[model samples]
Target: MVRRRFPVLLLHIFSMFAGTAGNTQEILYPFGPEHRDLETPKMDDGSSAEITLSISFVYFNIPYRTVYVNNNGVISFNVQVSQFTPEAFPLSDSRSFIAPLWADVHNGIRGDVYYRESTEPELLEKATQDVRKYFKNMPAFTATWVFITTWHQVTFYGGSQTTPVRFKCILLLNLA
Candidate 1:
């Protein structure tokens, strides 16, 4: 039995090393037909705009929110000012309107905070246009906008009119 086991072990060892020499070259240079050389493509002279906008309203009090993403990769937001009122007291005259909302954009590297508030309709439109322009010129892949909404005056009923609410708008661009 011992002699037979010794011969089997030697045969297995010899067979293992017998194929090692032939497989060495295959392991070193693995250039098979399936492996093809790939090259990076050059950038195009004219580029088209392809942008996606994701807007999330953190507070539930906000009723109407609109987000627009144009072909130039610009993003604009239009939130109804009157929707900030509490649902319980919708017809309350004492409720104060939204004064103006401020926005700041950060693109990982740099950040810019716009001090102007969107008090009037025209000003709000202009602010949206300005935000769109800012995003259009941004060369980064990802950007975030922080919107701070404040009320002009506290409501007499004392419901949800004291503190400021924040909304976030994220822009993701697909360069492919």
Candidate 2:
């Protein structure tokens, strides 16, 4: 018997991101050559090693200085997320999971996943502006730390390698 694969529809990936203890807003940050500083190794349902952030960020009153980004589109704090499918919100577990678009991503077959933490003045300034625009109530908001991850031209677990999706997730911290 011949097999046919159907496209898996996912929630608007860009609108999904995890943040510190507060209201989370969607910010469109540039994911260009300047931001692609590091890359996740090629693998199926794999994740980057626990990456330490430049600044400590708190979630649920807990501060985490380290995090990891998985090929399946999960930026986790406190632990590595091996789960490929996205679980319903208000997760059953206590681990901080940021599901950008958790999928059975097989990057080993095709594509590149990049992540980096930034404190560069220029980048920070841009992030600050973006946040301020969204949080008009906090007109003086300035983003001092940011974690950016992008799945550039990444293919699905069994989809055609030629067709891919490009998306990014950005987490910002403004302790001031």
Candidate 3:
């Protein structure tokens, strides 16, 4: 009985891999709020005053769609947040001091991320269809992984106009 159970367990684990681990690609979106300064009460004795600074921060994961084809192919799809308008999207609610200070894209693609504040819904639909078509033409994909990156500010003091924020994304591909 013990020997039989061992083989069953091994088969279960191996079967799980059948759907994951294949060609994968990642897209990233970068945005952030500004830095701000805070004031603190002075500790009596007429010496020096204290100050506390803070900023707002936000972070969330994007959803992805995984399609399993009849011929052992898999395709993953998701919106590219990197294309959102820097000014509109990931917008901050406050002004006195910005959160984030600065935002950037790391990993996946180098350089700066692009945004489309005025991008139309029709454009988005077209983009999605394009991606779907691209994958459909490919021979087959065993599995895929999709990832999204975001930045948020929490607290700040002032004089932080040029701080660098870091974001990252990576994709792994596997052959069956």
Alpha-carbon error at 130 in model 3, in Å? 16
Better of 1 and 2 by lDDT: 2
Ranking by TM-score: 2, 3, 1
**Model 2 residue pairs with clashes:** none
Model 3, range 11-78, lDDT digits (tens) per residue?
Answer: 00111134423322122222222212111111111111211112111113222222111000101122
RMSD of each: 30.7, 12.9, 21.7
Top-scoring candidate (lDDT): 2
Error of 2 at 163 (Å): 2.4
Q: Write candidate 1's Cα lDDT for 56-142 as tens digits.
A: 322224422343221111123342122322344233543322222222211112211111112334433433454455646533322
Q: What global local distance difference test value does model 1 have?
A: 0.24
How far is 9's C-alpha from truth in model 3 (Å)? 29
- Residue-level lDDT of model 2, residues 1-176, one tens digit each, is 65221111112243122223132223335564665668888988888988987666666566778988889888898888878877788888787867877788778877788888778898778777766666678686667677778786687888666656666777777765
Residue pairs in clash, model 1 = none
